[model samples]
Target chain A: MPATSGHAARPEASGPTGEPFLEVDRASVQYGSTKVLSELSLGVMRGEFVALLGSSGCGKTTLLRTIAGFMMPTSGSIRVGGRDVTRQPPDRRGMALVFQSYALWPHMTVARNIGYGLKLRGKPRQEIAARVAEMQALLGLEGLGERKPAELSGGQRQRVALGRALAISPDILLLDEPLSNLDARIRLTVRHEISALQKRLGITAIHVTHDREEAMVMADRIVILNAGRIAQIGTPQEVYNRPSSSFVAAFMGAENVVPLLVEAGGERLRIAAGPVNRAAAIPAEGRRLGGRVVEARFRSEAAELHSATAFPKEKATEDALVLDGVVMQASYPGGVWRHVVKIGEATIVVDSSHAFASGEAVSVKVPAEALFLFDATDCKEGEEELR
Target chain B: MSVLAETAAPARAAAWYWIPRAVLFGLLAFIIFGPLVNLLLWTVTEKWYFPHALPLEYGFSYWGRVFSPRGNAMGSLGTSALVACLTVFLSLLLAIPAGYALARLRLPFRSLILLALLVPNAFPNLPIYVNIARLFYQIGLNGTILGVVLVHTTHGLVYAVWIATAAFGAIEPELEEAARSSGASAFRAFRDVMLPLAAPGLMASAIFVFLESLDEFTGTFFVGAPDVTTLPLLLYTSAAGGNYQIASITALILLVPSIAFMFVVERFLRADVLANIGR
Candidate 1:
């Protein structure tokens, strides 16, 4: 897929009579005195996989549980396919959740576990058996039906959980960090399995995960949550390339941030060179550069390093923000060498193919499009930026 | 040379290891089977003096007499079985939901409530039995089978609640949530998921309650004397009246339910159910 910039994927015009499949409007959940979700609103289109991505305690799980009808919003309504199900119980919501722990019934055999929902719906024994067989084959779990969950491997158990959820053929599927418990090797395989199954079934799925790459690779749109509110909601490429806030920028792997001075020029913003940086200008369009002092953030991989003495004869590119720094420490991390470069008082990590010795001076070139600029005062306390 | 040494060393080590194990087995056998052997001999003895090392004669007369219609043994055994079954039923009925609540719900002073469930077992039985006797008398339930069953159920309910609480607590709440999300109603989820997962523990608790109620003596004696005669009370009264052979036979009879319960517990009441539930 070609990368889109700075815009959420537009809801399909023909999506089920022009309405979003699932709508969470102004929903807030309060636990005793503490509010976990504050007036959160989101719209998911039919067949769209929207990921609620956040660190722990960000209320992403709370929002997903609310949509699944496991939790009731203190106020506001949740409408699924044009029906308000805010006060409905989880069983009546016609949704299935693949739990993080793969919560298979330990006492039940694999077939029985997958058929539990069908049995609850009062389907005939034979029909339940048939559907269970079909699900077993679908998840590549043939000949393993009689085995209990404790007898199965982690990946097999995860597939059984998926099969169980899909057995009911619910309108929407909810995933709660379903891959978090698997080993790294198995997690990648199962992650693709879940994504492929969701796409093949065309089921509208809402996946909740703290892993950024998992959400980026799996979801059509990603909702980045911070402090019980959405920091930004956009496609993975848009959120990664053009984050709306410093928090989103930092969370999207832009951990190297440095303060810079800027002045609005005709059709461009002139960046003032500090004691450690060289002056440059970038187009002002689509940038919220109201203040003079702004935080310039870029990913470690986005910055290219050149030796201090080996100056190129060509002038500096208009789009590249060049900064001079002395390498304080260097380490080889696999294919690339990572260095801790000290620029004025701020230290940043820059990755380069070539290793630079410690205390060696170097020039770092960060392209204009790769540099995310946010207001200087927007920096939160205790935020870890230099990684 | 190393292989020879390894083989020789383990043989010597095995010889030394049997010493403590042998002593432990000898003590366990003596502690457990000693009284049982004496009881078995007593049931068949015709007569024996107190200082005699062995019975002077052996006969089947006491066994015959106990099985006879005049002995009232069968009636008392029947009463004991009925009371135990009733106690098991009532205790389980009350404990399943109570245990679920204690394990999963946000009750005020939950630990204190659980501690209170254990209060009956901790105190001396005499005061509790006296209080129960008084309460039963006022309610016109004294000297009746229902009253004895009620008192015995209270005796068994403590263990039922404790075992069921641990069993239900071992279950991951996420399993029930998974069921509910997969279109199982709360009741269906309990029946299909939680109940089956917790069946072994529940069965263990039920058998425990049954055994406890069957062996209950103080409350049954105090509340059920002269009318509702269960096996333990029968054994106690028979022995007090100096019918030693009949008392031994009755004691043997009492062992039936306990032995049967132990068999069931060993066969099904796995100790590792909690540890292995979500693994």
Candidate 2:
């Protein structure tokens, strides 16, 4: 893939071996003049669950629609199992999509809804019934086949939708936020069940989701999208721990941002002090720093808060960075106490087990391993981006 | 004692709260049904006098007169039924496709087409029908069932298209997407999903067209007079000639379907579909 495409290199574990089961090569979808999706390319390995993760209107759904052949791309081609299917209609693409709304036929019973595809294929009634029963059994909807979609609970309705899609046994499965409709508790269980089902069936699936943790829990590889382009694609752990950009870091819950000036010297990258962050010389190994000024980020839980006068100066800032701030407010969210600390003109959240007075002076220390650095100028910070 | 007084006072207030509503409802019922009761009384009246508030004698003699072989009421009713049915068929044949496009597709000048449908309903029908009848006369179609049916269809299409659009629009587009992704062709998806979901609304629209065509008078008069007379035309002639009994029976017959079908339309045109009207 070209570097300009904003795509991540294929993970080493799932490297390009032979051919991808579904390959979206240079797919560009445009609605009139506005480009909803730019020249996007993706290669999904057979039996791999890849999630297209992004905020709303970030083109994740657009990409899924294009892949499903519902919305044809203005440019580029889509290939499945090494065959060009860009011009084919959704029905001929041999991929089934489970819609977010479930989209069950209100007029039909659950059995008919699941067996509709098979019936359309001219399958015998007995065969269709047999397949419908099998899918119902797999999705834990065996006794609900006689019920209409409206009569089923939200979770059960979701399973009926899944059963309907899986009944066709297509080459690929596309899930468009199938669990987002369920209540929070139900969403958790359904998430696990879908992941287990995908693994058990060894089905190649592409899931679109705006929920970060949903993608983390359900997908093997997450394709992070931003502004109609691929920001990064990697395993959930990789993207969370080693995000390629500041936007990814912020999106992945490292929202507390402070600027830093850095110096690259042979084997070590030195982070100089600014208005908030202290000067720290850390190992540059495995760090992809390009510019002298960088944005330093650390999650709330990763930073340790201590009283300004009690903090150990001898610990040194050689490998760790510290910020001097005052505690603005504190709240207990279950296990830990979270505090909003005012550092210079900005506010950063810090979580510490030890209680601190609201107005007390404190210093937040983030170790080198926890601190994420990115080119400062590359991520333009604006007033509206404070969150 | 205080608690008892509070409970009793609220109970009394709540019980009397419905008094005004009941009176208003009674007034509305009277306004709607008073004329019908008079028409019904006339239909059965065997004899009456100028000084009598009610009929002096009551029987089904006029109904027999209207239904008998000598009466033209039955013949005119048959013509009306045929014309209304044809009007429904023609209106729906055009409306269904037009509605689907208006509801689902991004057709160019969509608002223009939707607005143009209102033009048939915008002006007084008498003048339009006069000009239309003149055109039909030139084409040798005046005084024929086909010409009246055509005129009724034009009137019925207004309701047919608008309501059908609302009905089809009320369906979730994702249902069709779900169908297509399940290996169904676009046409099959529409047949198996979109059509079934929109069926109730379309039925309601059809009923509206059917009822509108059935009760149509002015258009039928201008286009089908002297030959293809409908129930409304028959009613007009009897009422004008002071045969109140025959006219009342004819009106009661025309009203039967309207009353029956409005109930069905109420049941099928769901609140959501009703809310989506014109939008």
Candidate 3:
């Protein structure tokens, strides 16, 4: 394999691979009087693929552009390859960006688009031709080099954009939602192709995307951003399974969050779960009193529903927490059945193996570990409380 | 669907609205074209006045008299074309960059510059003509073709900048940003991405400025009286001199280019770009 062929060479250079290839320390960006990003710090290791995942206006794209040197941070610094490059221009910083719009020069052919950066850097004609040819072959664009961007398909235009960024062989590659313009199916295909290509090239990449699944699948680490601030940073599973905050938990597909009152009892904190579910145990460093239950939401797949008469068995796993309710609605979701069961005044959604009719009595067995608990006092459910 | 079918009666009635529209169009066409035909007839006739719609006599002697060896018909045509070309070139060179900067750049006090350009267009033309003639005389550009070209450029600059600025403003900044991120520099971005997209608008502004330079009478008459005789200036002078045939011939010369300019401009006017200027 080509991977093994390259891996056989002795590691070159003295710089430590452990040291961060790019560091954004306490970066704050402002557009006139409005502050877009505030005191955000992030680190990327050599050959690491990090995604700044957030919705629009969350400063994810702003952070990516700042790191590319298109935007100057009002405070703090950016160091790439151990060199302070905060005030450098985009072209001088040796970083290439693949814009969300696939900002290909419509007037130029695929080969010209791919070799534009090299031309700007003053590469000779033959060398540029060879490098462009290499990029075209690598991107599966061998015969389409003569076509303009307007002549190519959406996926092909994106590949040309990627090829252009990669042709420069910059220290880092920045992608600003490059897959956003593609159709959903094409987005998935191109995203996977981009991930494979980035890994093959062994280049550090910072991708900004609002698509949670895209971030989880493509990034080695996902940094969830909320309103211009870093809310959480972890591996895909780590962030999904053990989100430190309710925001991160919800962002990582834990769409269900219920308010809980914590009462400290030795090492295990008893969570007086909410109206819809029974109490559960969670480990916490208790420092506050119990608060009112405000909200409870959980993933539809995480909860289980069964006939109410079938009481909890003595050996229900510690991961399963139970609640009593009646099936308000049920649906067959291919593999498993989904039931929206109502318990008292609250409706708890759950998934079950067997189908149940509406108005049938049921119990929603929510795993204790799967339940995300947040104190009502700190739960505004808006950005103000999250910060 | 039933409601639409019931309303279809009024819609069918509305199709007859074109009857009045056709009549109005005919009236407007006759009002604009009638005097032009009468002027042509009078140019060839010996005696014609308000009551006579057509002439009894006609001859090519009017053209012979107007373009006689002693006449300055060719000289004035040469001057008019030269000044018009100069004005178009100078206005484009000055207006294109200023328009692009105003439209594309987020520069400080851009609205103030726009207001300054608009101020010249707001004032009456005679005051500007008098002031410009005095200024030119003071600067030793009194009766030269260069002086007239300068005055036409001044007048043309306002409308040129206003129209071209609007055209440049209508373009999507995303187009330029897309080019730059794909590795084109600021200059290349403008040349490749912006210029092609804005070609129709540039041509429209060019045609308007060319027509204005060809037909400016007051500025030339005040500053370029005897020495500079542009088409409009000579046409006005011959009319004031009581030689209606010469004046009609010169008017035809002036009218042809103006109509041709409008036709050319109409060919290049892209509804997509021009419609966005107001927005």
For each candidate, the DockQ is: 0.77, 0.83, 0.34
Residue-level lDDT tens digits of model 3 in B1-279 = 999998998888887887899999999999999889867776687665567666656787878866777788878998899999999999999999988988877889887887777675678989988998899889989799889888888888877786778778877775676555555677877887788777778888988999999988888887887788888887887889988878888888888888877888887777765664532
TM-score of chain A of each: 0.92, 0.94, 0.86
Per-candidate TM equals: 0.90, 0.93, 0.86
DockQ of 3: 0.34
lDDT of 3 by residue, A1-387 (tens): 111111112222212345677888889999998899998887777988988998899999999989977789999899988899998766567778888887777667899888877887789999999999999998889899899889999989989989998998988889999998999998888888999998999999999999999998999877888888888776676667656566776787766544444445566656554454556665544323344443344688888776776655333224455677788888886999877777665566677888999998777777655666654545554223222
Ranking of all predicted structures according to TM-score, beginning with the best and ending with the worst: 2, 1, 3
**Tens-digit lDDT string for candidate 1 (A22-86):** 88888899888899999888878789888999999999999998998888899988998889999
Q: What is candidate 2's TM-score against the reference?
A: 0.93
Docking class of 3: acceptable
Q: In candidate 3, which residue ranges exceed 4 Å CA deviation? A: A1-17, A265-267, A272-275, A282-297, A312-319, A375-387, B1-19, B39-52, B55-70, B182-185
Candidate 1 lDDT at A80 equals 86
> Against the unseen true structure, what C-alpha lDDT does each candidate score?
0.86, 0.87, 0.77
Error of 1 at B100 (Å): 1.5
Instruction: State the lDDT at A176 in candidate 3.
Output: 92
lDDT tens readout by residue for model 1, B20-121? 999999999999999999999999999988789999999999999999999889999999999999999999999999888887788998778878877888
Clashing residue pairs, backbone N/CA/C < 3 A, model 2? none
lDDT of 2 by residue, B136-156 (tens): 999999998899889988888
